[model samples]
Target: MLSRPDVAVVGAGPVGLGIAWRCAARGLRVVVHDPAPGSGASHVAAGMLAPVAEAYFGEHELTGLLTASAARWPAFAAELTAATGADIGYRTEGTLMVGLTADDLAEARRLWAYQQGLGLPVTPLRPSALRDREPALAPRVRGGALAATDHQVDPRRLVPALRTAAERAGATLLPTAVRRLSDVDARVTVVAAGCGAAALTGLPVRPVKGQVLRLRAPGGVPPGFRHVIRGYADGEHVYLVPREDGEVVVGATVEERTDTDVSAGAVLRLLRAAVDLLPELAEYDLVETLAGLRPGTPDNAPILGPLPDRPGVLLATGHHRHGIVLTPVTADLIADLVVTGTPDPLLAPFTPARFLPPNPAGPVGVTGPVGVAELAESADSAGIAGSAATGGSAATAGSASVVRSAAGVAPAVPAVGGRTGPGPSAPEEEHTWN
Candidate 1:
């Protein structure tokens, strides 16, 4: 048997799994390493496929990148669903950017102007019109804009589907952490681990912590939300995403931190803002409260592509809050680069060479990839394994575990399409930005 795979993907988050799936589907012998495949930022992601809704100032480049990926979601979702036989709960009804005060309406006008300037498809709505679209919205809403192209997916479903699809496509999932990289003699190795990539890739991948909450309607009751609602209440951004099974996800609180503590203050603020937007939410059951870390860059954009001097290494981390939205595009582009050795024009601006100094190394060593220092000898002494060809056989340590309920109580598994599964426990992604 070959000692090394054609590609070794570090990090089994959505982005990593997506890349592994694409590479394996293209006939590459691939292996993926992660403590948990779909947890981390992906587990807490709101899975909003909102390019237009997420647009902001001086991010036109990111907008183009996001829009390109957003355009790929429909086909990508359908293909993955067809392959995995799992419904990812992809909703296309669109997103409403509502304002709940006169001040909020002013902000909405500014956002609407910006969207219009970009030639984005957004429809302006009066308070009455907003109520007509989503009657559950608070009557205090002053006005809003609807980005009909924006959509969402349930990352909880997406992660499993991607994992199953990747394994089915022949990618081996090694449930362990990758603290360093060495010569694998493969075409390319990718580091897609969220904040964990910073240690291995030597890139400035920071974790932006966000706390989110999940709510469920009373049994036999409907969530009463037809489209995703992104509303501004008292100057805070709040969103309500309804699931097919009567669970509504209301999140999140953005705090720049490194710890994973789910603070009561954050939860109070999130739920309070959620109820301000959709008053009916006060009657729902608060099922979960969790915190996650989004792998962010200094500029809040992703760092992608290969290292100029590293012959077989790629950097696909630093997606920040947009990891889930950009998964498909990142997977396709990275897979193409790994297999064909050609850089797509879209990847030009995101090359890892932009961050690292150039150097030529004839062999993989204590120091692997570009600009990355040697792995600590202590790590090797701890039996975590080391060196060029060690794809550390699937260690049970740090294996993906079942998500626990965030409330420190038992989780309520809701039935979807007649199948009961784990409910929201820990972190996922955000539907709104701070």
Candidate 2:
């Protein structure tokens, strides 16, 4: 085991790995804990860097964060690739939001007006222009908008690249579920485990279920499209994202539950809507179906910064559907807090303190690091069970591996300086949609 780490991260998803990478690059002793590294929401994300397309009317603050994060993706991807010598498949072809009917066009116009009000960089595209840009789109498409700055990266490749870069930067990767923060011997512990953080901190984070499909374009048939298509048909939002490889990702259904089942109805709805937008997709082979849980909060914004009453613990979950898009900025802001004990202004609106009740107790920091035995004893007294260091489980259906839910029993300990038990077992050997 390495020396006692200065910081401990509780999740191994892209956000957690990015934080670890940045901290380690700054010479901070860092350790990341995850039962299955790089196999959470990240594994199933379509990796669309679409801040402009994702902006909602009332989420101005969130839009700012998303746009800032989007701006950082290019440099972040480049640096990660340069450091790890791994291709992350960062695509800059942009995105097209098209409507298949008059009603859909009206809805698109409403959104375009909203974007215009926000002074976003969206260009109104006529039907001819839209077709010229992406001839694969259905001829019936009425109108659309082009978010030329929005791009994408393959999360399957991004996660692994982040892990490699962080490891190379001297961050120790511990494939163990972190059940409790007291178990870690570090000065600070970061709860970035998506919904799993709710278990440790009693935060308001919960899981929002989503399902998506992956399809393969026929070999040299109908040719592949260049731009990502977010089309509306029969009031359904279906997106077709093409990869450098001959694969197109179609998604997703947003349901509010923890059920990991990939329903036939969801598959049908997505495919029916996608095929209506681009007929060629119907000829594409059905490659995979996936379902994942996005960690959500009441406001659907991330809760960053240190916990109010808990000392030595920071919250970094509740990203909802924007986890992939927000990774770079989340990592940057979190590394800032971890390295300098001072929060950045960019994190002011998303601070954990915003969720605290009135008359909150003054700030507290865990006095000193506790030994593994003492930490385990405390956890036992608290009735939190420890998670074993076993290999990762197979992904539920086609989603990322079943995440360690916070609503379960037997909480795991965050091994800080050195792990007390056997090392984590290998990740579940399985096929990814890559």
What local distance difference test score does each model get? 0.73, 0.75
Candidate 2 residue-wise lDDT at 416: 48
Could you give candidate 1's per-residue lDDT for residues 19-114 as a string of tens digits?
899877765578988766777988888889999888998888788889988999999999999999999999999999988899988998898899
Candidate 2 per-residue lDDT, tens place, 1-434, comes to 55556679889899989888876665566899887887778777898999998998899889999998899888888899999999998999899999999999899889878987998899999999998898888888888999999999999999999999999978898867665565566756788899887766777888899998999878734336888899789799998889877788899989898977899999999999999899888889998999998899999899877676454567788899898899988888676555444454566577676666633333332211122343333234433222211111111121111221111111122234333433223232221110
The residue pairs that clash in candidate 2, if any, are 179-412, 387-412
On lDDT, the candidate that comes out on top is 2
TM-score of each: 0.81, 0.83
* lDDT of residue 106 for candidate 2: 95
- Quote the lDDT for 35 in model 1: 61
